[model samples]
Target: MAQPTVTDIRAYVLRGGGADYHDQQGTHWIDDHIATPMSRYPEYRESRRSFGLNVLGTLVVVVEASDGSTGFAVTTGGEPAAWIVERHLSRFVLGAPVTALERIWDQMYSATLFYGRKGLVLNAISGVDLALWDLLGAVRQEPVHEMIGGAVRDEQRFYATGARPDLAVRMGFLGGKLPLHHGPAEGAEGLAANLALLADMRAAAGPDAWLAYDCWMSLDTDYALRLARGAAEHGLRWIEEPLPPDDYWGYQKLRKALPPGTLLTTGEHEATRWGFRMLAEMGCADILQPDVGWCGGLSELLRITAIADAHGLLVVPHGSSVYSYHFAVTRHNSPFSEFLMMAPAADEVVPMFHPQLLDEPVPTDGRLSVSTLDKPGFGVRLDPGLPLHRPYPR
Candidate 1:
């Protein structure tokens, strides 16, 4: 059978939480007192939004084939990303065959290398790549996992990321990852407060439930080591992203120094196989956590995972919702996926990209059956009611 060529590519930006889960309204645990790079300033310490964390909004990409079938994806990159898509990346996508993903991804990445080896441009490329995968799956009438490789397991287990680990334990999750609420700038007092909170959570969650801290790239190597030691008493399973994504030296030191039970993990903000290679080869982290929406999408992720597999490292993608779900179930190394509790209080299992997507699946009792993802593509539709704006059109 002949594959349809790409006919049109549309890029749109939307405000509020979708793929940019941080672009949420009102007071949410993800933003409240979460440690960050900007936490050195007293003004920005109280809220992440105070520093424009949500400035990127959401980038939506739609790839249309000559057969009139369209596949779309959402990621964090607002108007600036839409401009990159319509004015630049679309050239490689339009008129290409639906299955020409590797060529399309290479062209998009190479063309933008001068300005974008990482960050926003990569986010845009990831959006387009994911949409292309969706397009390929649609054209072939198959789910994405089937296209890449068949599922290795019948179900995908999940660990919840939120403020309420106790609630997540009750929800049947394998574990809960809490955001580290303080940073190095806060000093010893902050460290005490951090440990105290963990102790309280450990009491609430009980001893056997897996509990971990998501440092979110907000701690120093020394502080992270200290935090790990303090957390070891509470049986902390892991200390994730304690230092910034690029600090391989710090990661190497911290990983070696961490308590016996605590694993060192990072890489959500890191992009591409090249970047991840640094992490794997350097022995920087035990488990690599790349966001499919930011780490060059599924195409590059295939490469990243292969590298991890070679290095004997696990590739657990950060909160990418269904994008992670499809990939997780297929890979043996990705034994479980993450579910970011979107409920304002972090008390319930809301769809990770709520209001922006329809037919999105959430883990029932902390597990998603492979059958739940049997539908074609990613098995979800964009909520047409979203207030998406086209900043640039081609």
Candidate 2:
């Protein structure tokens, strides 16, 4: 029996240019239109715009005894997810052992503890953890799914919830998740429109498939209540980020208030399983949406899912989505995973380690196969086939 010792961890900083900076700017402008006054708080962005460098990261894990045998993983911080990784993270990663992924994750987390306890730091660790997993698989000669455990289902069923409802229906993806068309910042009208849209999507998706929608915290107590009530008949499975991520009580209320059948879930931006534990203790959500990178990578995701499992909740690891399919398949309790309706221009801009194969207008079956690693470690390769350019000065 041989166990491989981790050799070194390298942070490959990937960057690229050309994006729908204008379109993203337009979307943020809409948010700015309504949420501007709320920005009296300092947490708002520069000039209230959301367009920036879309850095995609992957952790290249190397083993002591293996050559030409290391592996990689995805850490997608779409838009600005890269700057946070390279500017602050790469230093912490160099010289670390690949096998100490979870431990190294803690060290990196501790380093970033003073400032970014949740968002950027954990997201970076996610990339590292995944890379380690890929490396572990390659070094040990196994698939990531094999190392994590085994497949829960022969094939994972996914929902392209990132799609607009009607468009998703047209694509034949019965299960679809909708984004926040409006938010609490917009007041009652926003709430009203969301509820109506939920109804329309449910009618379109019909009874058998799952139809989920994101609140993206556009809802306050009253708004969530209103939409939750109206959304009952439409057969909506779950509503995501219905309120602010910190609003645990709001989720508790929504969980109880929204008819008993409606499932509540979140955790896309939440950083660690510690946050998830709180949500679990409070009965905050019916499901947990720990993003791999944000939630401290697969290490914490497994722990968070365990907590969610104890709480009788389902775990749905949210985006940095490139890794979701494989992670979902690996987890025994992962019920579903999500994907963007259409691959982002960033995928073309920044050469992500893992290149997506399905470029259909939409996923016909709502499922995509994660690259099956025959070697050790997670085998994500950022072989970007797009016209690469310098997205930033550095």
Candidate 1: count the clashes.
0
Cα lDDT for residue 305, model 1? Answer: 96
lDDT value, residue 226 of candidate 1? 90
- Minimum summed lDDT over a 10-residue window in model 1 is located at 253-262
Model 1, residue 194: displacement in angstroms? 0.6
Cα displacement (Å) at residue 337, model 1? 0.7
The residue-by-residue lDDT of candidate 2 on 316-369, one tens digit each, is 776444455556777667866665543332111121222331221122355444
lDDT, residue 377, model 1: 95
lDDT of 1 at 26: 88
lDDT for each candidate structure: 0.93, 0.58
